[model samples]
Structures are given as structure tokens and as C-alpha cells.
Target: MATKTDDPKVLAQNRKANHDYFIEDTVEAGIVLTGTEIKSIRQGKANLRDSFVRIQSGEAWLINCHISHFEHGNRFNVDPTRTRKLLLHRTQIDKLFGQMKEKSYALVPLKIYLKNGFAKVLLGLAKGKKNYDKRQDVAKKDAQRDIDRALRDRQKY
Candidate 1:
């Protein structure tokens, strides 16, 4: 019973991606989906939490993404964790392949959304963050929050 909106509606997001990696760039890519899969996504039954993008044989594939089976799909239901192909321009794919050659670089799916009634994924070119880097990010966020709080308090005085 999820309501469809005129604006693009996000179906799933990887909230941990930002905390675990430093995203350098992002690209919007189309995903290959079955009828049942699309139906399930429209109902907001999708998870990008543990999903990651991989390039093999010059093609990008989405792995570990979970798109729940449509309750009414019955025999049409596909595996929730099936590997889905991602569609990108030839140039874009080549660029991603080049960047991925570096050991530190990775491709991650940031979120999935409906754009113009078609499903799209926001893919990120990211570098993994170390434990210390994560701690630093947390500290910066806390400091920013404190500054905002002080500004709000000052406005009330």
C-alpha cells in the first residue's frame, strides 16, 4: 500500500555506505528487473543494505541486493538475493573498470529509486575508510551538531 509520488521515490538506501567508505563520485544506472521484482519494489519491499556492485567481463553486476518477493507473485517470484545486471553507458563502464583496477577503489550501490517510473540506482565510486577515519568522521559530525545547537540556543536568547 505504498503511495506513489510524482517525485522520484527512494525504495532502498545503504545508510552505512557513507560511514564505511569515502564516496568519490556517483552515477545513475538502470537495473534489469523482472515483472515480479518491479512489483515488489513498488511496494517498498527492497533492501540495499548489504549490496555491492562488481564489474566482471566488462559488465557491472549488482550482488547481494535483496528485493523481496511479491506476496501475490506466487510461482513468478524470483530469488530475493539474485544477482542483477546494471546498465551503464560503454564509456561509463570503461571508466569504472579503470578506477576499479586500484586496490583501494570500489563500486557501491548508494540507493535505489524510481525515476520517471523506471527503477534507477545511484552507484558510487568509493574508497574504504579505516577505523581511525571513521572515528574522525564521527567527531566532525558531533562538532557540527554542537555548533548548530549553540546557534539555535543563541537565537532564542
Candidate 2:
């Protein structure tokens, strides 16, 4: 059971985005939500996995996000998986749109959190990594971990 706080404790994160995409930039945008949606989010019933940002008609939106409906709210509940509008400044929206025209550039949601009592999503402007790139990254991480362990052991013994 997750408790709602004024400062949002992260409920879910898209870890795959970090592994698969080279995040060039990040921007925080507020999410528009209804009462029930807000309640559900407070309960930690949200998924950022398989969710991404899209710019259309100069507006940014969060698509494919699953925010489960509030269990107690019946007829008053809103759609759980609706495409929600993202609140971003005009300049930021324009910049995002311009970069999105390039091939292989995409907008991925890194995480959703409550900031100052408002729901905010961290959007990443990223480029997808190739298979070899991922493998190289994994190897580098393994090597770094081994080096750290070796140094720690030497310091103790």
C-alpha cells in the first residue's frame, strides 16, 4: 500500500529506456488528470512502461500510459488509458517538435512523480541504441564493477 505525499515518491520507472535509448535531453511536464485518476496514481496503480511522448498540432501528450481507475469510484471514473495532455511551455514544445522530425529520434517517458503536489513526467529526447552498442555498454559496466571490487579488496587486505 502506497501512501500519497505532497512530494511524489516515484511509483514506477521505465528502466528499459535507459538501456535502449541514449537520452540526449530531459524536460519535466505536468500531466492533466481527473479526480479518480489522481486517486489511482496515489495508490501506485500506474505504468510508465510502453509509454512515450508525442507532439501533435504543436501540443505534447503522453500516450499508452496505464493509470488504473479508482476502485471505489464507479460511474465517476475516467478512462484508465486515455492519452493525457502534457503541460509544456511553447518554446519547449517547439524545440521538441523540431527535433522529432529527425530520423531515429524519439520521445520516451523516464518516470512520473508528484512535484509540488502536481503530477509531472520526465520526458527524454533519445536515440535508440543498436545491439552492439548495448553489448558494449554491458561489458563496460561489468569491467567497472570488477575494478571497483578489486580496489576495495586491496584496500582491506
Winner by lDDT: 1
lDDT of 1 by residue, 40-101 (tens): 99989999988999988989999999999899999999999999999999899999899889
lDDT of 1: 0.94
Give me the runs in candidate 2 sitting further than 4 Å from their true place: 1-8
Per-residue lDDT tens digits of candidate 2, residues 41-137?
8888999889988999989989999999899989989877899999999999998888889655899999888776677898999999999999999
Query: What C-alpha root-mean-square deviation, in Å, does candidate 1 show against the real structure?
Result: 2.7
Return the lDDT, model 1, position 70: 98
TM-scores for every candidate against the unseen true structure: 0.94, 0.90
TM-score of 1: 0.94
Q: How many residue pairs clash in each candidate?
A: 0, 0
Q: Which ten residues in a row have the lowest lDDT in candidate 2?
A: 2-11
Per-residue lDDT of 74 in model 2: 96
